[model samples]
Target: MTTRTSRRAGGRQARQALRAAPLAKETRPVRAGLEGGAYKPLTQAGMERIHQAALDALEQIGLADAPQSGIEIMTRAGAILGDDGRLRFPRALVEDMLAKAAKNITLHGRDPQHDMNLSGTRVHYGTAGAAVHMVDVDGREYRDSTVQDLHDAARIADQLDNIHFLQRPMVCRDIPDNRDMDLNSIYACVAGTTKHIGTSFTEPDFVDDGIELLHMMAGGEDKWRARPFVSNSNCFVVPPMKFATESCEVMEKVIAAGMPVLLLSAGMSTATAPPTLAGTIVQAVAECLAGVVYVNAIKPGHPAIFGTWPFVVDLRSGAMSGGSGEQALLAAGCSQMHQFYGLPGGAASGFSDAKLPDMQAGWEQMCSNVMAGLSGLNMVYEAAGMHASLLGFCHESLILGDDIIGQALRCVRGIEVTEDAVDLDLMRSVCLGGPGHYLGEDQTLSLMQTEYVYPTLGDRTSPKEWAEVGKPDLVQAAKTRKETILAETSRAHLDPIVDQAIRARFNIHLPR
Candidate 1:
């Protein structure tokens, strides 16, 4: 009896020690840019049909409201300016641009360790949205999201391993001027994290200022161009085939500055787009293909993400249902379209219609995120920290989302069938000569960290153990973690002198 107790206790100690040990980046069970594509929501024939329909839409329906400059550039690239002023694309022209568009693009980070190599079926997840309200989880209420809230969110995200990139998730509603709001958004995100960032400019004139701020952050314009870590998430097209004129101009300037562009086509189904899911995807594809032509025309082989963000709406109420199963299918189907075009693409997922990160939010966020990762989306935006159908952002939810994405990424990794993995010798030996079980096997201990993922806040204790630990609530635990992260000062921000210079030159909103 004594020997058996000692053996069990020793086994427990070994596992605890192993759990506390640091793992090399390569050995971690989940990480950025894991290969996916195992899930095919669209068949090859269906994808081919969608492609043809999109091409036909471009050739016949075309897109209206292109800026005069866009008209000139695309017209030169073989797009015909119709009598009604819509820019119609020739099938040959789209094909040429598709061939000319940049592939296997890299989104650089201020730190080299965070750079993402976007190629093949490599999948990366991150946060992206413009929620105006911040969910106060403790209060169970929403309030205006301030610049400080944005900064805090970024800092919290910087420490999360599963959040690969940090986009401006919430707006600076405290700032009154549009230009200051845009510039401050950049400052807050860049100052908080060294990961790759995605943001948008409100006006074309603001592009130069935004670039100047980036140059300052990068130490110089030449150096910034060498490793442009920020990307412009431009909503270049409105739903149902129309161009957003101001955003188009902003795209041109950002491209000239050598920053990557995300050609975002966000249409609301059953409202801005067709009611059918297939038709919604076709419109989004056609619109983004037009954007592809526009981008390549401005600069041959520019890096642009095919952002097909088609939103779903509840038919009865005409409200956005970002957490519905239909939303998951829309994102997954769009990922298939991105693969079909052979372009680095991104789509929206992980949003929750729930007011808080509760049971409904858990299922909603997980369903779409898992589907998006499995479908091999090159970039999965809004994969964390969005709630209230994207009207609210929650910091505690963002912290909780890290754990959720870890599990989702594990699913993306799927099963590996190596010779060693399937070997029966170890099993045979364990059953025959070893103790009746493999609990203390050397191989079992070694594979603990690599073969499985353990969540940071997920409870895996028995009911008795849970009582001993005070039965910690998940949301409260996340809240505590959020506070702990924001309490510590980060070393990733710019040096004091550089920050002072930036404050002097630009209207920096967040306090020092």
Candidate 2:
């Protein structure tokens, strides 16, 4: 009887020790900058064929609607501006600019700890989208997003371990002035998080105004240029081989100011672009290549993100299917092409077709996210909290997406086949010795936080435990997490003096 009692007491001690095991963030299993590229959806020959096709499209079909400045830049860089107004790029010029394109780039965060190195298949996932409406998880309704909503989203993203950076995810509809909207968007994101930010300018002049504020935040023009935190997510092309004149002007200004530019070419297949997936990839690459020529012409070697974001269309409805399998394929395939060029690139993923955060959203969000990460995408944009085909942003969904991305990043990290991992001493000990289980074993305790991942808001309880805990709703849990984060979150990633000065000069919307 004493022997049995001693065994039971030992079991209690083991359970208490397991419960006390540390799971510190610094020792977590997965993290940003994990090398992905394990999943290659396209063959070398296929990538080459696509590349040649893109080059052929650029050389033969060319692009239309170049601003006079674009024409001047391209013409000086071996491009032919025909009488028909199509600015045609020579194969030589495209190839030359490709060589000049910045391959390895560092995306700076105001807090240096969060900086990401963009090269090879090093993958990082973050938020992006111009979602106009905020998904109200509680009310199950949508509302026009305000600047406060954008600021809160950034605050929540700041705390999410998996969300590596911040991009303008929603529009601040309340700010009517285009200039204020541009500057305030930067202020809101900067104030909310020190993570690398991506934002846009509606006008060229707005880019100047926004940069002035960014310079202030960075302490001066030189410091801001040395490590610009915000990259311009400029949609420089209007698909179908047409340059958006105003957007191209903004890109030029963004480049001149030393801000990284995402050469975004958003074309929807079966509508603006060709129907076939290959054709869509071809067009998107061709457009981004043209952007490269334009940028290199202005400056010999400038930082630019090869953003070939093409959305798949639901033919039956003639609407963009951002969460469709086809969209996933397009993003993954484009990532392969980025590797082909040996340049830093971005493509869209982590979007859901569902209007709400349901099972449908779960499947849709994970599908593209895993595929994009495994394909070795350098920057996975719009990888969280976007819904309704990119028209709505949900804060609760964003909170839950942190959990999803954690799992996805784990997939990117894959299995580390170290000799220690393969050693079976622990296995033999567990099978042969004391408790006949590995629970609380030395190796198990040691590897707990390093070899495994735990979700922040996701529940993994058994049915009995779930019931014991009141069977908490996952969505409600996410909402509660959101509230908790916002209540304790800081928008003071920026220095108080700098933030105060920004608010003093600009129409800063978010309150203290």
Candidate 3:
């Protein structure tokens, strides 16, 4: 009896030790660039039809209101500037430009370790949106989001292993000037995280200031150009096939500055686009294809993400239905279209119509995020913290999203079948003559950490244990974690000298 008890104690200690050990970067079960093409929502024929429809829309319908510069650039590259003031793309010209477009591009981060290889079906999830309200979970209230809130979100995302990139998630509502707001937004993101960032410019004139700020942060202009840690999330096209003229100009300047661009086409279905899901996809694809021609015309093979972001709307009230099942299908279908063209692509997901992070929010966010990862989206934007149809962002919800995304990435990782994984020697030993269970087996302990994923904030305790621990609420736990993270000093900021120089040169509104 003594010997048996000793053996049990030793096995328990070994299991505890294995669980406590930290996993190496390479050994983590889920990571940034896991491949995920296992959930194609469109058949080959359906995708082909969508592609042909997009081409038809571009060729037959065309898009209007291009700035004179864009008209000149595209016309020089074989686009037809119609007398109707629309720019039409020939199928052949589009094919040629598509040939010149860059593929398998890398989105560099300030820290090289965070670089994301956006090629094939590799998946990376991050935050993106222009929410004006910050969800105060404790007070159950909504307030305007400030630059400080943006920085705090970035700092929180920096500590999360699952959030691979940090895009400007909220507007600096406190800053009234558009140019200052633009500059401060970029500064806040870079200061809070070393990950690759995406931001937008209110006007084409502000692109120069944003570039200067990036150059200072990167140590020099040449260094910034080489890596270009930031990308412009340009909404170059207005819905239902028209150019956002100023935004198009911003795209040109951003590309010239050696920064990448996300050619975002966000059309609200049934309002700016067709009500049918397939029709919305077609319109978004067509608009982005026109954007592709415009971009490759400016600079052949310049890095651009084909951002076809079509949002859903509830017809009864004409409200955006960000958390609906239809929205998930829209994002997945758009991802498939990007795969069809062999270009890096992104789409919006993980939004919630609920005002708070409740049960409804949980299901809505998880369903779309899982589908987005499984559909092989290169960059999954707005994958966390968005609430109230994307009008609000919650820091606590963002922290909870890290745990949710971890699980989604595990699904993206899927199952691996190999000789060792399937070999039944250990199983046979346990079943036939050993302990009659695999709990204490050497193989069990070895594979435990590698073969499975554990959530940092999600609970998996038994009812008795959970009750014994005073029944901790998930939202409360997330709020506590958020507070702890923000209270801790962060090392993600820039060098003191460079920061001072930037502050002097620009009217940075954020506090030191």
Candidate 4:
């Protein structure tokens, strides 16, 4: 009995020690930099105004024909329908539903073992939707992607630090069957890489397959259900319209299965809706809300992200150009609408119609990136490497995008608040004699590292020094950075048996 008692005491001591030790440090802080500075905290009055605007648009003009189920739901909820199949949503009902939606959520990645926290100060980055081009290692460009290209792209994305999510499609590849192709692509990516995945497919069975793979990686179905691999299921809403049957079915499955989905609506001004930005925005909001209502109807607390990539149709060329000032305005409005629902907003800022990485690309990317970041979208998709109006993705463009995203993240970080940051006392002491000397001061040397962000790409050296080293352009610098990163960093290895099983299932031999 005495021996057992002593053993129990020792066990208690061990447990206590374990509890005392610090938890394994999170890879990054949950909330870094300034608190709540990045977000524009909306007041109750502002929400009411936005809500009223949405209602006015719905009631005055009414929305166009949505899916049959969507029409039925709106009718049941006392939303008025016109002869033209326009829907007029009840303001009260809209407000009530919006009140119940979850504003903040953490999206799980390839590993159910880890997730990207979205609330508070935490920010996650990813590329934008559906592109058709890819750039190779030897500066060669290829269009219309294949499975092999996707695999290599996933491998490269897995090795990047700033890129935290896989947005699918190195290029749309051909498989034996469409459903099988979707499943194989998703499986290949989740199995081969460690980053969070963002994918969208048209088939329910394909979704089920992707979800099953997520389950396997998560160790169980329940774990997978609790924190799913985040995906942005795209559904095209007919202009000034409602959801389609296929879209409704997809949204229902996602909700029923308790998976997070982003309701993406790409409304074009003048072509899809009205020519004016505000009118187009109101129309887009109604369409997005209609989607939200669908998801919420299927499951009251289903995880849904509100997204819009609205652009104006160029009157001259009839092309979908990405960098118009109107696009930025639409993005800001989308952010407001998401905020109204207390849901996370999704938008992309860095995209261009320029065919190459030139001034047009730089300006467009920078403008969009800044607008999206300032608008306070929770997840900024296409924050990197998009060109030719989002028709292409280049290796060099991606590297440049990393630097741009880092800059945007730094902007959101705002100003740091600490004794060292303020340095009131130190400044007073050093400046009391009127702009004297701080270079020789011990405090200056001690604090410089924490105060500055040393650039990985931007040139900080003198012009003379830069010229001596050949004065490389940003593209060359980006290329050099990508090469160095690929050479120096190693991809994280997965469990050997799991890896083998995945490859075997796909009937693809593992590269030696």
What is the Cα-based lDDT of residue 129 in candidate 1? 93
Candidate 4 lDDT over residue span 22-133, tens digit each:
3333322221122222444345565566566667776676666466766676577667778876777677766666666666777776554446655432445667666777
Model 4 CA deviation exceeding 4 Å by range: 1-50, 57-88, 110-114, 119-123, 135-142, 159-161, 174-176, 416-424, 428-435, 440-449, 483-494, 506-512
Q: Looking at model 1, how many pairs of residues clash? A: 0
lDDT of 3 at 291: 90
TM-score of decoy 3: 0.99
Q: In model 2, how large is the Cα lDDT of residue 188?
A: 84
Model 4: lowest-lDDT 10 consecutive positions: 28-37
Each candidate's TM vs. the true structure?
A: 0.98, 0.96, 0.99, 0.81
Model 1: per-residue lDDT, tens digit, 1-512? 67657767788888889999999988999999999999988899999999999999999989999999999999998999989999999999999999999887999999989999888789999999999999998899999999999899889889999999988999999998999999999999998999999999999999999999999999999999999999999999988899999999999999999999999999999999999999999999999999999999999888899999999999889889999999999999999999898899999999899999999999999999999999999899998899999999999999999999999999999999999889998899878865677666677888889999999998999999999989999999999998898888974789899999999999998889
Regions of candidate 3 where Cα sits further than 4 Å from its true position: 1-4
Can you give the lDDT of residue 343 in candidate 2?
A: 88
Model 4 Cα shift for residue 411 (angstroms): 2.1
lDDT of 3 by residue, 420-465 (tens): 9899898888778766767767777888888898888898999999
lDDT of candidate 1 at residue 274, scale 0 to 100: 93
Candidate 3 global CA lDDT score: 0.94
**Model 3 poorest ten-residue lDDT run:** 1-10
Tens digits of lDDT, candidate 2, 1-512 = 67656766776686567557855656778788889998888899999999999999988999999999989988988999888899988899999999988899999998888999999999999999999899988788999999999999999899888899999999999999888888888888888888999999999978878888989989999999888999999998898999999999998888889999899999999999999999999999999999999998999779899999999889899877998899999999999999999989999999998999999999999999999999999999998899999999998899889889889989998998999888988788768855676654667666766787788778899999999999999999998888888888584467778878887888777776
